[model samples]
Target: MPTPLTPPSAPHWPAPVARTAVDATVALPGSKSMTNRALVLGALASAPVRVVRPLRSRDTDLMADALRALGTGVAEDGSDWLVTPGPLTGPARVDVGLAGTVMRFLPTVAALAAGEVAVDGDPRARERPMGPIITALRELGAEVDDGGRGALPFTVRGRGLVDGGPVTIDASGSSQLVSGLLLAAPRFAKGVEVRHEGPPVPSTPHLAMTVRMLREAGAGVETGENVWRVAPGPLLGGERIIEPDLSNAAQFLGAALVTGGRVTVPGWPDDTVQPGDALRGLLAAMGADVSLGPDGLTVRGSGTFPGVFQGLEADLHEVGELTPVLAALAALAATPSRLTGIAHLRGHETDRLAALVTEINALGGDVRELPDGLEIRPRPLHGGVFHTYDDHRMVMAAAVLGLAVPGVEVENPETVGKTLPDFTGLWTDLVRTA
Candidate 1:
């Protein structure tokens, strides 16, 4: 197994403070979600595929390496990735590296291999919920030996095929559970019919992304009220251009709202299944003038600090990934905000809800943790250390707060490399130009 990434000696990074309203155009990297999904589909394609402008972050890299270990050829062609599909063989070791996508999405792909595939990851990856997928994969005729742990550090004894048919799972914990099954279903002997039996699945947009991408690859897919079916067929290989990660754009756009500045992210898709696209509406609700045009998505803040924006009251069930930045903005709002319908965040990189509450309150903010979400009442926030808990989004939240609250030191800021490697650099540029 490969060694886990190590943090630098200096763990605390003092976040940049914005002295003026930030007015800049930030071009972000490709979507990590789309990039990883594309890698999976490309590897499963019948022909060579090219992925254009894919994110080169830790999470996406792990996906590429995992596919390579399964005998797929992933090569870099300039800024693009050329994926050559090969016979899916195993007896390989996969290190998931604390990436939720890797730990959840790759096992089904491994199941299509001919031999044993051992999967493990960072310590936290072992604590994540894997039971639902494990149970569902077994029901679909894959032998997964987790030593009864039902999590990571398991082995999938592949038989070169999976008899995928109807399998039910409680995907309430994560939408990835559903996406993982559907992505590899095209190769299953009987394809797959995934039916969710428990609570409403979080991050529904991500599921839409999976279905759309599958159809784009020429796979037959059908969706119903609470179920999805992918017919066994060939996934076509072709060029796919990934859009900018709008989720990563959250902090930059939130900078506009917090500092009463203007920020725009180019290459914003008019229509996207990425949950980050919801930021347009969410940021607008918080009093930012949002517009999408030839210049991409532009967010103009109404006013700077002391010029209060309205608090937000909404259910972020569909876009739970944007919770941290939105929560940070809520803490800086003029009124109280109630964000609900996101209990599933408890199983994310960390218990995001608890982390947000703890970190925000540590800076002397008033945040109440609810059963499913967070309630933020605007309070006078002071400078203090904001703990990231090794979650990338946590680093983003701290950056947003640092723009308004001085002396906000962030611990383990390097964790942002999970999705955006140049996060600190980009943030400093935006703030410096402010």
Candidate 2:
């Protein structure tokens, strides 16, 4: 197993409480989703490429390192990454940490290499769903040795090329399985056609994002009901500027609703496939004034204690990653909330539904775990410790709760380094401005 990134002795951080309405403009880092996808596409390109404003986090760093281990050149220039594609060869070992993207996405890239690539990750990572992708690889004409465990600690004994064709997989667990195959498909001898065969695949926005990036990189792609086709072709190499991670912007925006303050995030794209963009509608449903213009997305809360927001009922299937912060907001809302359509969350960094229910209830809230989602009924809350379970979003959720309920200590706040390395600092500044 890869060395655990979080030490058992990691200190807990006391989530800062907001004393007044916060009015601040927070600038966020680049998207981890985009950064990793860009890196993979760049490494498969016909020439060198530049990924501008890429996220500098553990997950993205692991992606860059994984590509480098497979003989790609990933050099840093200021805040950007310049990738030079080389012959894909490996006798390499990849430590995926706790990053789902690195574990699921890198294996396909490794399948294009000429030698053996051993892939493993942190202890919890071994428990995540990897069977679909592994099975898909074998069906697509690559050799994956999982020893029948169908999980991590696998080896891809690459023959330097995959004879890609139509293959079926049940991507209900995660969309990364589809993206992992699609991102590396352009390099396959015959490209690839992927068809989903089980329950509805979650996170459709992420799937769309993958397709968009592939096309932008010059690969011919087609999509239908439940299938994706990538034509065999050379990917163009050039500069690709990454957008600010709207998903990571969730907590900052949620803070506005919690404190009845105003928070603006700059560079909110006019058009994008990021699921985080759904926050505008979701927050509005819970009673927040939201606007987007040249100044970017701005959210203003009801400037009153307990703010004039009601509980929200929505299906988060396409935007499941937003559940943590949204759940925290639900616990503070004036009415009860029910968030559904995200059963796949059970496979995330932690069993998020259970974790949210347990942590919030520990703080004296009423959150019940549903089979598919959570039903949160607001209750008077008090200060207590909120365990992160090595999940970054869990830390984000705790921070949102602390704005109203004092003494919310988050275990292993450093786990936020998975995506947003400076989350605590940014959150502190936002609260301090209040």
Candidate 3:
């Protein structure tokens, strides 16, 4: 009966509306997983590491605690963290908050420890998946016990993993699986050889970013298209400057594109591998002017807004998490949009496709649900009360619909705290500029 919320203060924008002429530039938050992964890498390496612009979020904080539990010298120096790698031993407890990354990644981080670590998190975190990590860890000689059948509140008894050479992980379900195991390989007894086979991998680019960052930290990693191999070695301490999240920028881009305005997001990584950058192309296809710059990226709106002139069959398997927002766009597009390759959305914080259809349809959009994705036809949505289905993306996506169309009230905006805690403030700032 408990549901996450946006907030009462944020305006309830209605559908079948449009953004008034507006223009503004905004800054983005740092990547939560990337910072935590970098910190973990720093802890597993033999040198001191610094993370520039690290995010102060629940997820990252949990990772820091987990890293510290592993005997890593973790200290904060302003926005930077000074981490010294040492021989890490597991602790009696590891709590990962509500982070999917921490739950998945810490299981492997525990494999490198020498004692029994009972890992758990908040109530919602208990509902998330942990099977892939448990299966992989067991195969690699880790004694892991889940809630009962490899679930949470489980214990991973580590005797220091022997190099489990050439492991194959079906990470298509969650790219975090790939990032989790790959980063933990260097600490394995025999190092790790990971072969990833799944439907089409979700968030391949973010997984690739994990691989790339590991190598930068001094781990030997070879990612030959599909397969990834990591050699056992310490990640050397170094400084990694994490850029503002491009993923978060995609939402604002949606905001500007929906409204008749130019929204510039500063400090985005131009050459970054984050797949959220794919939003640039997705929005452009719908008739938005998006540009990348040295300091950031900008989205100039199209008042005409051809509205997803491209065909509706979008392969969102790589960046499927964006389906909720994209679904809203599809609802307002010239033709129906069918998003495929994301059955995994059902397993997220909420059943996203269902949430998309239920909330959007309630708002008067012609949205329908499919087994794996959705088929949405262009329709004028009448803003009313939009339920966010306890999902942060759902809350924000409904908010996006508000920018162009007025009268849509997003229920429980606080759910945005899962990632962008600054949502209300950011919207206020943008509204002020407009």
Question: How far is each candidate from the true structure, as Cα RMSD in Å?
Answer: 2.7, 2.1, 3.2
Give the lDDT of residue 300 in candidate 3. 79
Model 1 segments beyond 4 Å from truth? 1-9, 304-307
**Residue 277 lDDT in model 3?**
80
Candidate 2 C-alpha lDDT tens digits along 27-127: 99999999999999999999999999999999999999999999999999998999999999989999999898899899999999999999999888999
For candidate 3, give the lDDT of residue 12: 47
Candidate number with greatest TM-score:
2
**Highest lDDT: which candidate?**
2
Across 24-117, the per-residue lDDT of candidate 1 in tens digits comes to 9999999999999999999999999999999999999999999999999999999999999999998999999989888989999999999999
What TM-score, computed on C-alpha atoms, does each candidate reach?
0.97, 0.98, 0.90
Rank candidates, lDDT, best first: 2, 1, 3
Candidate lDDT scores, in order, read 0.92, 0.94, 0.75
Clashing pairs in 1: none
